[model samples]
Target: MCGIVGAIANRDVVPLLIEGLKRLEYRGYDSAGIAVIDGRDVRRVRRTGRVAEMEAAAQSEAFSAQVGVGHTRWATHGGVTEANAHPHISQGVALVHNGIIENHDEQRERLRALGYQFESQTDTEVIAHLIHHHLTQGADLLAALQRTVKELTGAYALAVVSRAEPQRMVVARMGCPLLIGIGEGENFVASDVSAILQATRQVMFLEEGDTAELSRDGVRIFDGNDEPVERELHQSDVSLASLELGPYRHFMQKEIHEQPRALGDTIEAAMDVGFDAALFGDNAGEILKGISGVQILACGTSYYAGMTARYWIEAIAGLPCSVEIASEYRYRAAYANPDHLVVTLSQSGETLDTMEALKYAKSLGHRHTLSICNVPESAIPRASELVCYTRAGAEIGVASTKAFTTQLAVLFQLSVVLAKLHGKLDEAEEAGYLEELRYLPGSVQHALNLEPQIALWAERFAPKSDALFLGRGLHYPIALEGALKLKEISYIHAEAYPAGELKHGPLALVDANMPVVVIAPNDRLLEKVKSNMQEVRARGGELFVFTDQDSNFSESEGVHVIRTPRHAGALSPIIHTIPVQLLAYHTALARGTDVDKPRNLAKSVTVE
Candidate 1:
């Protein structure tokens, strides 16, 4: 995921574009560049590494322009160098693009035959030249953009500014997020809402194949045929201060607490159960029932959701399910059947690994394809039979908190839906499941209230260099995620093991010096988890249990217990994840680490 911003200023806009890019650098920061259209011509600057570093390099120049576009790159088709940075300029037309132009190789050959010279090894550079080529042939900017898009394949969100037409910025999207912000006397364009939060709250989300021509006065959108289209602008409630890392010390922790609302919004993305069948409409249940099996591809937290879904889908829907990491899914020798369904999940929907995996799976001719995504109009969504979008709005934290929980919620709901379709679960059982699913928002909200207690709990263990995480079944993955989060920000050496794995080998590491964080949520594994805790205690390991208050094994001899209100199935992880998030937050704070922007990690892994 790359972050792109373009502005037609009623106010001085350089500072606004730069500051916005700073907040969004978590998306991608391999290199950064900006191109401003001065009255005379377009002035451009480019540099490699973090945006702060690039800004340092650009401090010597004075760039004054009312219209401009900026991009922070996560290199995909080219090496991370200044030459490959975005805002690629050709004949005074600067282009900053996100997503891949899949036909770049063939298109590059044709352009070379036409005597076009390229300076960088990026698919984006091809766009700058392609647009310039059309303009030189006497096509207007909008006409050139439209004609050039006809030959292009795959996903792209492009912002083009031309020196010849100094007042306007041309933008188009096929499979990514693109927004136009309406301000007092100007307008703004960005890949996400956070980048333009300070400029204007009113935004129009560009639909696929819709081209936008933006100027200081207004924005005009057109359909693929160059026909004018009506625009719908929604006022964003996100404040500038929300983008800031406030008193809690980290955006990750703040985002974890936002799950209650994020989940609510995700469910609201499609509320009609009785009418207008979601994603899969009137014949959804029938088609799903006929499908033989499922193949799922995702990465990071989204992949964890897939792992959890396999359990639920198999048990509840009686479907054979296979989950693979997006990065590896394509390279392996996969077994594909025409009756098999392919499912892809991503929060940004522009993730490079997942996108590639999705295209490859589609090429195999699956029975059906579905995308569970947060962004409604993205590449994967466009290439699917159905799309179940998670409306977890604008997760700002580099580490995905709300996104992971909401993805799990969607998968959980889908499992119940499939069960109802297959006649696997009875009405009483199905109602019970849905009823518990509905309570998740309230449960997660209550868990967020335990943040202060979690902060206190973090105090005693921050100095420790190593921690152990234990759980069983689904909580096993939650333990892995907890350990991963702790290590991700706190830089602690943490390992997760199924509680039963203690006697197998992990118990060897337990001693008085070891501090273990046990993810003992109330489940079928609680008794076994208690036994694992006792073994750790006998060996003098400091134990911490995140369990329900009602469990009979309330207190270990020398261990600390962080009790939950009650133990509920499927919803426990949603609640239990909060305390782990808080613990990671406070631990990082105590250790004086950058909790919001962790070292050596970007928010979106757009590059493979």
Candidate 2:
């Protein structure tokens, strides 16, 4: 729930660190700070607001240092204040962290007993004092970090520095993301790729329990056993052009407009050449072969993604799939069998609830776990046997546009592969599915071109304070996601219910002021969804329906129907999701909130 950036250069590193923080603003923006080394002393600058505020503060005369580490924070453990902002410092150790310290109380108590004083209200400040404590005990920076981290509990991705040792930086990761970018006489580290993409594309990914000691010249890796380990350095291959807005007003708007290319990238990269039965490879499909059912665990947008996947699994793969929010999955014991596959979906793949739930599933002997994620090398992927990664690249906006669609695509593709492998789908049916998959890229582009229709709809209804989203079966989760998006950024009161659930309590909330968004996509559930639309109209609700022109939904009463391509219901989850994304993007812009970085929300959920 925070963004961290660090760098050391033969030249001054403050400017590079500032640029990296600007890139990371999408991750978090509530408070910002940077601590830099000035001739073996640390000078700290911090602000209690956006990155621009901190940049303004840093440019003042008093704050200047050579080598630095910075952070933009989303408050998790403490109130938002300038002192609570990251790059928390002690006498010499200045630290930037991205995850929560679950046992910070113990660490704090121990540090206090050792006569160390804390200066801020954050779990991260304990790390500063702990590192300082170890260094005071005559330990070197790397050894002090190693020994200090051993006493800590819970997930973390920490980048620590010591003015006592000015030439190098030490980093360690447990369940959070940390990457090192190689540069010419300068090196960089960040919680995500977006921060360091401008400096270097070549990076060394830090695995769990691995520590990296970085210097002006190079980086060295060591394992938990204190043995030197050789690491493979991969050149990050993402195109920088995808990160640009290309004249769009906001990143949310640019991302909504980029859905066509994003979907195209996912589908094109997913096509397998042969009838090979190994799409869910690396012993992941063995869960299906070994299990009789599936339990899916996820949270928020990914939870909706899981709900959509449940429909495909039941309809296409002929498997029973249980979809549950991960925060609730552990509290209740479900009736399970050994043959149950636990699947999880996450855009960042580091969501705390989902990660903990997956571990609980494994401990319960649910051996088969599959993860669908957009980011490569995310924490959840490391725990799963089979992982289908969405190559949608870096999604910066807090309200996900591409990652949600790509998760469904990957899940759908996985279901198809499983159906073929398990003999649930024959060769002819498989070929038909593949043919539909081929048209996806064009269909997504077509839907994107209809943004004018969505903008017009927004103009018609942006003044309303509340809305109702209705769908059925696979479209049910799409409506839920649509409502979540509107509520998340626009601060609008939005509720989604299964189209059939209108009379079951949701109808009581429908009125003249309520604008209803009915997803009338052509599917087996079309008639039920149409009847639901009429039910809403009977209650004096204005209808804005998205449907296929080829479908009979156009003739439905009391609804303004906007027609899109008539794709299969399985494909409609990705195609029909476009207009709702547009509506939220426009509505947030109308409400005058930060569309790209919504308040109290971060792009990546790094901490629990």
Candidate 3:
């Protein structure tokens, strides 16, 4: 996923565009560039590195413009070079894009036959040339973009400008995220609202196959059918300060520390008004009564959250549950029943794989579709029949921190809600569960307090080339998440296995050189986990145990124990998640790696 920002205003927009790109730096990018109309021609500055370098170049060259479009690109079809950077220009038409163009090679061949020259190895350059071709054939900027997009196939969010139309810009969204920001005497476009939040709080999230023309006058939108349409304008409450790294060294660290507040806010609606099936939608109660099972589709960390939910649903609600990775699920032949509810989880609801999996389930006659997402306006929530919003706020870090914990909090609530509806939980029992949810934020804060000790443990883990994570029962998914966090940020090789499976094959690789991390929360499976810990110990594997306060684990010989607050039943996974996050954050710090924007990883996976 890349970042796109555009503005049409009376004043110079170079500063605005640069600041927007900086705000979007957390999305992960290899190069940054901007294309602006200077008087009668387009002036461009491209860099092969960070946005700061490009900004410095723009300043040294005295580049200024009243209308412009900027981009931060994560390499997809091209190498990390300035020649392949965004703001790709062709015949005086310049554009920046996010998402893949599936038919790029075909289009490149067709354009080449038509005497159009290509400069870069990017799918985006084809878009610039195609639009310019249409403009040459007597089409306006909006009409040309409309004509150009019709020939392209695949996901893309495009922002284009032309030298002939200095005050005009056009933006389009096919299957990727693009939005228009409303400002006084000025309008903006960006892949994420956070990029334009400094200039405008009012935004309109464009739906599939929507294009809009932007100018100092106003914004005009047209639907897929080429007819004028109106989309709702939402007032974003994200503050400028929330996007900043206040007091923390990195956004990942700040987000890790914000887990308590994030969890509290995510479950606030359930806590305040009590859990009604209507909290999900108007007909969720009826839908819940008719469902015999749940089929969850998700990707990455959200998939792990779904894996954890599988344990909760089957045990608490007595419902059959299956968790499938969305990317793989879409390619396989799977059974989808109308009586089973299809649930999709994504932090940025625009995750293409999960969205496609939801469509595939729908195509197979599944009717009850629900989505758990953080961005309320994102595509998945809007596409699903029912929705649950996780209010984790803006998760800037490429490696998720707050978003993962908040997803677990929401999934836990869903489990309890299903139990109550199925007569598995009575009034008193439901109240007890609610009480546990009430104290969750404080429990998370207690876990946050373990940061000091975990940071010390991280120093010991920093030099290790590989690590093993082990857990049992409901905590096994927590182990998987821990290993993911470590590998994502620290670049260390890490793997997780159910504790019982450790003896089967993974034991052969255990030795003093390998560090073993175990999740031991004093549940019924505590003894089983302790047995696995011994298996690692016998092999002389250095052990790091994150246990509960009363678990009575001691630091002796090769064993190191970091205790969290006493386990909260059913919600222990969310609590155990805290220490592992801090461990990864601090480990990345000690290894001198990029924690916020991890290499080769984008915050949002907009393309499949």
User: What TM-score would every model get versus the actual structure?
Assistant: 0.81, 0.95, 0.99
Model 2 stretches astray by more than 4 angstroms: 62-66, 269-276, 282-291, 334-336, 553-558
Error of 3 at 79 (Å): 0.6
Q: Which structure is stronger by lDDT: 1 or 2?
A: 2
**Superior candidate under lDDT, 1 versus 3:** 3
Q: Per-residue lDDT for 1-608 in model 2, tens only?
A: 68888998887777777888988888756898899888978888888887878888888845665568999888888798887888898887899988888999998999999998877889999998988888888999999999988988988888988888889999988888888888988888888777888889988888888788999899888887666887778788766776777798887887776766776777665565533335456565555566667788988898898898888888888888889988888777856566777888898888878888888888777767888888777778888978878877777788888888888877888777667667799888888888878788778888877887787788766788899999888888899999999988888899999999899899998888899999888787888877887788888888888888688754444578888887555788888888789888888777788888888888777665
Which ranking of candidates, highest lDDT first? 3, 2, 1
Cα RMSD of all models vs. native, in order, equals 4.6, 2.1, 0.9
The 0-to-1 C-alpha lDDT of every candidate, in the order given, reads: 0.80, 0.82, 0.93
In model 2, what lDDT does residue 334 have?
A: 55
Lowest-lDDT window of 10 residues in candidate 2? 270-279
Residue range 1-608, candidate 3, lDDT tens digits: 68999999999999999999999998889999999999998999999888999999999999999999999999999899999999999988999999999999999999999999888999999999999999999999999999999999999999999999988899999889999999999999999999999899999999999999999989999999889999999999887888998899999999988888999999999987776787788889998878889999999999999999999999988899999999999999999789999999999999999999999999989999999999878999999999999989899999898999899888887887788788888888889889999999999999999888999999989999999999999999999999999999999999999999999999999999999999999999999889998999999998999999888788999999998898899999999999999999999999999888889999899887
The TM-score measured for candidate 3 stands at: 0.99
Which candidate has the top score in TM-score? Answer: 3
